[model samples]
Target: MPYFSICGVPNCPNFAHAVFVANYLSEKLPNFFYKKIEKIPREWAVFLDELNRENKWYTHESPVIWKELYQWGGTKYLIGGLSEFWEHVYCYYGLESLIPKYALDELALDNLRFFADKRRSEARKVKNVAILGAGQLNSAILIQDLLEIKTLRKGGVHLVFKLYDHHQNIDRSVFQHLNDTALHFNSTSFFGDFNLVELYSSAEDAMADSDIILNLDDYNPKDADFGKHMNRCTIRMKMLADHLLVAAKRDAKIIFAGSGPLCYMATALSKACSEMFPNIVVITADKGFPFVTAASEETGIEIHRISAPVVWGSIGVNCFVDIRNAFFKADVYRPYRCSLTAPKGSTLPLGVVSSELRLMGYKIKDAGVIERKVKNNTKKMEDLIGRASLFSKLRAIGLLLKLWYADEVGDEIISLGVRSNGSFHVPKGMFFSQPVKLSESRVWVPYSNYPLKEKQTKKRIKQCILHAKDVFGNLGIMYDPDDGFDEDWDDYSKYLGEIGEGEEEEMYE
Candidate 1:
């Protein structure tokens, strides 16, 4: 009827031996029971000291043992260290087959690995994601996407979404409904156990220790004046940037998802915190363009198969989609064969053909059809949402986040608003939407050598850059033409065919 407690550092040889003996005795003796308590090696000394002070015993090292003599009027008995326990068991139970030194060392090594792996597993399970201005509809869609996406389910990651919005703006009922949905899904779905949604009263509390911060703040102005909108957006962006500087970690990615000049806002935030600029990004609405979606619907091809349709310039205005290098994988194509009936020396449009996959470059002749479809779709979306395609934008954000979490950056090309490192003819210190490949390190590298042979493409890109500068100057974030002459401004002015008095006003407009 003896009950014992064994305490020691987790990976100690003596501790392993003590545990082995205790297990052996508990199995043979029907009335015997024991408990094992493990402490890390660094914390062992303090624990051992406290144990000795409480028990009035002077014992050092690991494998400290004690017996509770509850059967005999609840008296406590100290049994000293590992050797003493071994001797007591040997004399009392007549057991003498001691574990070999090498075996005990191996046992300790196994315990060390187990402890290390357990710590790593715990670290991998918990991921903190902060959503700023989470009361928006797109934010709700994003939350649902994160919870239900199959790609995220594979990692066994427990997602903690910390939602923050202003007191007047935030919807508590929406949060309550989402929480109820999460609970219901967690019981029914296989991977929904890993999802959790939390609401925070303060922005600082929500953003603290966040691995990914999504800025879904609704900053678009109701005013029709573009200049006034930019000015208001600039003021709000600066305030958010200041908050992020104080609360966000150095490595946490701050993704801007607001409905404004996305590239300019991202650039302004990046300039505010230069050291963390690389981690700041804006998910572009390139893949969500009406033309891209129309192509998918027309050809019956999955939108993901259509890759590398570069969206250059900014998000809303002065943006251009280049499909010159776009490739699509499909099982069927138009019934035009490259035979003698066709033009002489015409070859197949296929790039890579295999048993499982056939990748083909998009034909330039289909551009007219796609353009018409784009116009139709654009008009429909504008009529519905007033120039804001909420569903498409939500899908784009969801897709980007899925790819980002999966970290399987293959040959897929995505358009992201990232800080320009003077690559792809984009100016440094500005955020521009360009075709980029995600590296294994999770960094988005712009395709610097991507060809821009078409004169119109080049001209459009130049105009976008100028428009970005004008917007920044109007908001007083960076540029100021009235103060003094700048090198980039002077150079762009000369390149754009010597702007006249009337042309200057038109360019800004």
Candidate 2:
């Protein structure tokens, strides 16, 4: 049987789509098969343990829970929540179901008729077709829809199944359930064979002599909370993307499925294939899920929603307009927040994650892990500035320290500034992380460039470094300048001095 696959991280909502389409296609068409990718769960567990320490979560049992914790804490919150993730799977499935079962059979019959006429007119070429990402449950439904499409297309397209997973352990019941269901329906129109191999590797080998690469990998967060899960998932996804890019570079037509996140990933992959492949189509069904929707905006990607049945029959129907057209017509790249509406702007979808975080006593400020590097870097700069080194080499080294501190320690500096903004504003329990530099200069700033409680920002920066040293043990910046910093911090003092001493003020809009 020819193969189609669905690839996703553990507990992926999109997995439902894979399972649905695989079984549906297999049952409706004899030559088609769907397979999924699985990974070694233990390896994931080890990785989780390592990350837990860095996060300071420190849970010894239940790697599954720990992984989920990481994801929920990381990017998942930044976007929306798990429900939004599930909506992607649901919308794709729901839309697919809208295609009447018999309607697809009729379409298949039409395709047979069309191919018959064409074959008689000119010898028909054998089309080796495959659908990727077929392991998820929804994939079974997607498969059924594709079979109806085949009948309408006249059964000319042959298929080969590619079910790829990293792990050998697929819940046997799921496979048995699908195999049994497929065997029962037993339609004889599909062409090709089925083989389940390790993902990406198998996909790469299969694409070596193939004409089309159907991609279905998206939103895979390995063992982390939803918030940080996508980070690891994207690493493996990049490999599959590279393979698709190679095929596209070789002029292969690509059809992709899934939600907004997948669409975002596709932009980079498609660009790689852009020069080689003439047409690239991404089919997504956004059910107005907040997370995927916000992610769509954040990534600067567009998803086109078409009637599911039309896609199954391979017929184009009323399709979705680009998100910008549907909402913000201009300022398309504007950041998504609570304040944005449609035609002109759309309000950000308030989701359960953020709401739940608030309910569970999680503050938005606690969303990220604070890096320790900021404190260390700040001290190196302070020491270099205080040192009156006349030696050119020592002065040169000091200059580099201040630049590094300013750039890398921006978050540390900001945290100090915000703390000075007042105990009432930022308050306790709120922490700053993920330092980013500000490029714009403001003559009339909201707050003075000083630390809270009338302290100099530089002094605060220096004090934080000293506190860290006392807590974590002496890191030896002032003790050993050469070993402490990479460069001369003395000369950098001239630049740091310009920041000046001033009273810190409130930092609110």
Using lDDT as the measure, the top candidate is 1
Tens-digit lDDT string for candidate 2 (342-460): 33444544323321100101111221111123234335755987732123222222222233223233322111111111121211111111011232331111122322222232233
- TM-scores, one per candidate: 0.61, 0.29
CA lDDT, every model vs. true structure: 0.70, 0.33
Model 1 agreement with the true structure over 258-287: per-residue lDDT tens digits: 665778778767766645646777877544
For each of the candidates, the C-alpha root-mean-square deviation to the true structure, in angstroms, is: 14.7, 30.6
Q: Which is the leading candidate under TM-score?
A: 1
Clashes of 2: 82
Per-model tally of clashing residue pairs: 0, 82
Worst 10 residues of 1 by lDDT: 354-363
Q: What TM-score should be assigned to candidate 1?
A: 0.61
Which run of 10 residues does model 2 get worst, by summed lDDT? 306-315
